[model samples]
Target: MEFILDTVDLEEIKDGIDHMPISGVTSNPSIVKKTSPEDFFGHMRKIREIIGKDRSLHIQVISLEADTIVEEAHRILKEIDDQVYIKVPVSYEGLKAIKMLKAEGIHVTATAVYDLMQAYFALAAGADYIAPYVNRIGNLGSDPMELIGNLQDRIDDDGYDCKIVAASFKGVEQIKNAFNYGAEAVTAPYAVLKQVFANPNIDKAVTDFNQDWYSVYGEGKGICDL
Candidate 1:
């Protein structure tokens, strides 16, 4: 029901987190590259202070080994707020880590998904969330929309808790399509979310409505003399 800004630049993320209706933040290696080379925990500690403990903050692990990944997940969660969600990939190692983490009562986000099958696999593996790279899949000559559609249908028809998190949104249209496909949540860059509400037509319509209201009555006076 809320949009999560997928960015690593703390300033940019903070800007959106402060003004926009962004429910959370998701970041991967690529996103991290855009941030500082400082310690990852340092970054998360600052983020926790900015977002508070009540909000969800997703942080990905660097380890590919299941044991290492699980350990890293625990360490990361301990450093950040209690709402920090771990991001696990859809692989054999990731599955193992997810199972271990979930058993430990740590929330896990199954990321790097491609199709409905992967989403199903994530659910079968018992992940708390499923992140499908909509635009990245589109770039691969695949219909991410259809993939998400089938995923939603299958999940709702069977009643699964693995939520669909639409990731890698390229534009505003992609955001709309992800919503239409009934993605539980969509993670996009701050720029994309900013463009989502930007439209010349909406601007013109608002101006026209204001002018019409001012004509009969007065500026900022939609109510008549009473």
Candidate 2:
């Protein structure tokens, strides 16, 4: 499974990549507003430099119309490298944009997917990835895992070359459940992902191990010192 950070914070990106097995970075207009970069394209370029070309960088389009969305996709490709995945929400017009971009061989990620029908439409339109809002769906009184499971079944049964990249998580269990339900990847906040290591017992175990090591080798001495 792939773990993607759904934020545009520069330091968080660097630290998350350094510490965790980060596969990519994802950003929406809201996420961008959090960082409020002075130069948008330039900041995205900086992110590309940090993550390198091998990893995926998903950037969303602000336009709502098909023509403008397609235009925005091209501009994003021109501004950032061509390898960037253009994130289009799964709307009526967004599907049209996805079809056009796919025809031109541009990578497209369908976002803001809520209904199973919407995801199916995006898959039919040739979206490379379909992001279902996990927590949001749950908050709406629906089982997000059921949606993910059904979507995965459709993908496997139809032999679609699309992946389910579940998004909008609030806690770590939700993330785990997403993967358990057949999500190939998930994009979550760095702080939420870091909570996987937040249990006090984990810290206590490490501290005890260090104390025992120090008792034998003395304080301030590491294995390298020997």
Candidate 3:
């Protein structure tokens, strides 16, 4: 039931962490390209300051080879903080890197997972978190929820410590579905997550309650005022 943000925007991260019970912030190369910060490591450090040490910060590697990926991860850990989780795509080389990182007691989040087999591989490789691309999977004509559910079942049955961190959401419903299907976490855009409170019915209910209280109290008189 962890709600994570999928962005590198500092202001949005601050606002989201301030108002929401966000577990962490996750960013891939594509998301980082949006911000294009002049000081990459500095910007990441600032993010850590905002979220504090309690929350997790996931940073993806830019290399394609197994050794290079491991090297990039080490550099990121050295530059940022070692507590940062390295997000490696679930590929042939990425899986190799995950095993190596996990052997070193480094946190590894296996990303770009679109199928159950990929998730299984990542889980077996000791990934702390397995990220499944929900929207993209659906676009590929597969039920992403089913995949998440299956993965959850496997984790529960085998006593695996790995968690499913669902990603690539285009709508809030998809995010909800991920949770409903047993995803331990779901990372989505700021706007998509904020839209949960966008329903007019919620606002209307709050406004009506306030109006009734004002009518009885004769205005400007709250429970505290009384």
Candidate 4:
């Protein structure tokens, strides 16, 4: 399973890659607005440097038309690298764009997916990754896990090469459930992922273990010191 970071913050990206099993980095316009980098392409290049070409970097296109979306995807590849995944929303125009981009052998990630039909359409259009809005689906009184489960079944039964990269998580449980429902990947904020180790009992257990070790080896001493 892939644990992708969903932020544009350089420090968060660095810390996450350093401390966790981060597989890739994903960003949308809103996420970019948070950082508001002076040079957009330069900032993305820095991110590519941090993660390296081995990891995926997903960048969304702002164009609403299929022609412009294709143009933007080409420009993003030119500005960044060809390895960058072009994130296009799963709309009528977006589906068209996905087909066009895929025809050129460009990586395409279908974002803003909220329904099974949208995902099916994207899958048929050759999207490398289909992003379903987990929390947003739940907030709309629909079961997000159901959507994920059905999508996974389709991908398995149909033998599609696509992956479900679930997004829009509000908490750790949402991310957990996304994986449990058969999502191959889930992108969440660094803060939400960090909460996995935020339990007070975890800290308490570590403190108790250290205290027992100190009682025998003296405080502030390591095994190497012996």
| The candidate that achieves the highest TM-score relative to the unseen native structure | 4
Task: Report the lDDT tens digits of candidate 4 across residue range 39-137.
Answer: 999999999999999899999999999999999999999999999999999999999999999999999999999899999999999999999999999
* Candidate 4, position 176, lDDT: 92
Evaluate residue 74 in candidate 3 and report its C-alpha lDDT on the 0 to 100 scale: 95
- Write down the worst ten-residue block by lDDT for model 4: 135-144
The candidate maximizing lDDT is 4
Compared with the true structure, what per-residue lDDT tens digits does model 3 show for residues 81-137?
A: 899999999999999999999999999999999999999999999999999999999
- List of clashing residue pairs for candidate 1: none
Candidates' RMSD to native: 2.7, 0.9, 0.9, 0.6
How many clashes show up per model? 0, 0, 0, 0
Alpha-carbon local distance difference test for all models = 0.84, 0.96, 0.95, 0.97
Residue lDDT tens for model 2, 109-221: 99998999999999999899999999999999988899999999999999999999999999999999999999999999999999999999999999999999999999979
Residue pair clashes in candidate 4 = none
Which residue pairs in model 3 clash with each other?
none
In angstroms, the error of model 3 at 149 is 0.7
lDDT sort, best first:
4, 2, 3, 1
